[model samples]
Target: MLLEGKTVLITGASQGIGRAAAVECARAAANVAINYLGDEAEAESVVAEIRSLGREAIAIRSDVADPASAPAFVAAAVTAFGGVDVFVSNAGICPFHAFLDMPVAVLDRTMRVNLHGAYYMVQAAANQMVAQGRGGSIVAVSSISALVGGEYQTHYTPTKAGVHSLMQSCAIALGRHGIRCNSVLPGTIQTAINKDDLADPEKRARMAARIPLGRLGVPEDLAGPILFLASDMARYVTGAALLVDGGAFVNLQ
Candidate 1:
């Protein structure tokens, strides 16, 4: 019960990594604010599962990419859970295209949702944590793409790289206030992001060959690390980027 009695707000909690994080928070005995931008039914189902675990949970609709939406989200979480102990910025989009032919719209949407959304959401969440006058944790879901540039994922890479920079800068700025900021960079998780690619046997095999772990990552695989970073287990950790890539980031022979 590392996070017993803590409250965590996770965006994009309707499915994939975000959903897994919500369940992990409950397992850690933390009440959860599950935020989703769409698929209300799925979000509600997640809340039900959390409650079934004997922890408080609620679904809130929010578009992370919208500037006005994050503060409202924080306000709703404060109303429900007294205040936030952890905030996970998990909502993002990936639209891959080669640089030459990449559409401007794809770039704009990727930057808005992945980078700008993280900035504003963290701002709002930190405001709440600061006003509470208690130390808090902030975790952003960055990508391994931030570390190693991927081909055809140009639109996706820049935003994730921005996230790493954001985490470091925010951690330094907020440390004195007892606030910690960090990012988790995952590689080739078996989520909606890689569904289309994995559908192709060749692409899947190629990806597996690169991963020393011998398999693609599951959303559940990321849950543990995220929970640890959000809990007191990682109290001394801030201004760090933990790569949960199953050796994908390492040059393992």
Candidate 2:
């Protein structure tokens, strides 16, 4: 088991990539602390599944956007699993809106959930890890949108970019403590958040055609990379933005 005896805390873990990562971590023998915002049932389901795999799991209700929620949840995880060895900041919101038409509230909400939330989580997790003196890994779930402009994601892109920057900065600051900080930038993964955009067959086909891999990624596709980053395999890696985009970024078309 790659993560045997490690405790991993994952935010937005009720569904999609976050859920997948939780399952993967459990499979690797890591006790999981799954955090969700509103969906209690979904969160519980994940917890059940992890328990069935013979790994300890707990469902924590927390809105990462809330300033206090990050530390509170971290403390909760500590109470449950001793300490956090890995923190995956996967909670985020992406609302598509043109720049000119984007409302102030939407932009602010996006920043609250995506940027500020990640910052708080990282800070809290780093503090906990440092206190433990065992070092740790922090992986922010970023997006390829951070590297390229999105016609409908003017506000969303910046938050991801900010998250990427946050990881890089933390990598430098936390290295002395033996903590590693990095990010995983997933491309067009079919998740509930983007279900509508992908529901249109024409739109989906067009999007797939642009990717060199000829298919959209799934939540499971990103789990391995995330697990690697959070495992001892990446002991020397930090300040990295790994692209799990299926070659979409390099597709000239």
Candidate 3:
């Protein structure tokens, strides 16, 4: 019960990595507020699962990129669960295409949701955490793309890189207030985000070959690290960029 009695707000909790984190948080005995942009049904389903875990849970619909909506989302969660002990900014978009071929609108949307949304969510949640006077944790989900650029993923990389920077910035700015901020950079996790490619045996094999660990990561594989960062176990750890990539980042033979 690392997070017993904790209340958490996780953005993009309808599916993929965000959804996985929501369930994991609930299993850790944390009441969860699940946020989704457009998939209400999916969000509700996740909420059901959380409730089944015997923890309080709710589904919130919000566009994290919308500054005005973000605070409201947090307020709603706090109203439901008393207060937020942890906030996980996991909402993101990946419009795959070559940088040179990317449309302005697509790029703008990506930035707004992936980078800007995170900032707004953090602000809204941090304001409450600071007022609580007990301090809290902020765990953001970044990606290894932030470390190593990928082909046709220029826009995605910048946003993920921004997350790493955001985590460090938040930790430094909020440390005096007892708030801890850290990020997890996952590599090649098998999620809906890459269903098309991963579904192809050849493509999957090719991708796995690049990872030093010899296997692709699963969403559950990330839950432990994220929970640890948000738990008392990581009290002294902040402003850190942890790579849950199973040695994928290491190229040493």
Candidate 4:
């Protein structure tokens, strides 16, 4: 029960890494607030699973890209759970497109969801945490693409990089309030967004070969690190960019 009596709000929590984190936090005895953009059923399913663990859970529908919705959702979660102990900014979009093929619309949409959305959520969460005077943890879900260029992710990578920067800045600014801010950079993970890309035998093989770990990551693989960052274990940690990349970044080939 690392997070006993704590309340955690996770965005994009309907499935994938966000969902896994929600379940893990609940198992640690934290009340969970699952936020989803569109999948009501999936969000509710996560809520049900958390409740089965004897932890309180709620499903919140919010589009992080919407500035108004970001604060609104955080406020709603506070109302539901008393106050937020952890806020995981995991909502993001990564549509691959070659640099030459990238369009303005795609770049705008990507920034809206990945960059602006994260900024708004962090601001709102920090404000609430400061107001509570209890301090809190904010974990932004970044990607290894932020550190290395992705041939097909010219626009996508920038958003993640921006998120990492945001985390650092937030960490420095929120430290005085006892708040900790950090970023988690995940490597290739088996999520619905990349299902088709990884389904290709050749693509999967090439990707696995590049990773020193010899396998792609699963959503659960990141849950533990995220939980640690959000827990008291990381009391002295802040402004850190942790790579849960399974040695992908170290594999130079």
Worst 10 residues of 1 by lDDT: 244-253
| TM-score on alpha carbons, each prediction | 0.97, 0.99, 0.97, 0.98
Better of 1 and 2 by TM-score: 2
- The digit string of per-residue lDDT tens for model 1 on 1-253 reads 9899899999888999999999999999999998788789999999999999999998889788899989998888889989999999999887667888889898998899999999999999998889999989999999999988877898899899999899999999899889999999999899887787689998888888888888889999999999989999899999999999889889556
lDDT of 4: 0.93
- Regions more than 4 Å wrong, model 4: none
RMSD for all candidates, in order, please: 1.0, 0.7, 1.1, 0.9
Candidate number that wins on lDDT, 3 or 4: 4
C-alpha positional error of residue 41 in candidate 3 after TM-score superposition, expressed in Å: 2.0
- Which residue pairs collide in model 1, if any? none
Model 3 / residue 1 / CA error / Å: 1.1
User: Candidate 4, residue 97: CA error in Å?
Assistant: 1.1
Number of the predicted model whose lDDT against the real structure is largest: 2
> Tens digits of per-residue lDDT for model 3 on 19-120?
889999899999999889877888889988989999989888889989997889889998998998999999998877787788999899999999999999
- Which pairs clash (backbone N, Cα, C closer than 3 Å) in model 4? none
Order the candidates by TM-score, highest first — what do you get?
Answer: 2, 4, 1, 3
lDDT per residue for candidate 2 within 1-253, as digits (tens), equals 9999999999999999999999999999999998899689999999999999999999989788898998999999999999999999999887777898799999999999999999999999999999999999999999998999988899999999999999999999999999999999999999988988788999999999999889999999999999999999999999999999999999875
* Candidate 2 positional error at 206, Å: 0.6
* Model 3 C-alpha lDDT versus the unseen true structure: 0.91
Ten contiguous residues with the weakest lDDT in model 3: 191-200
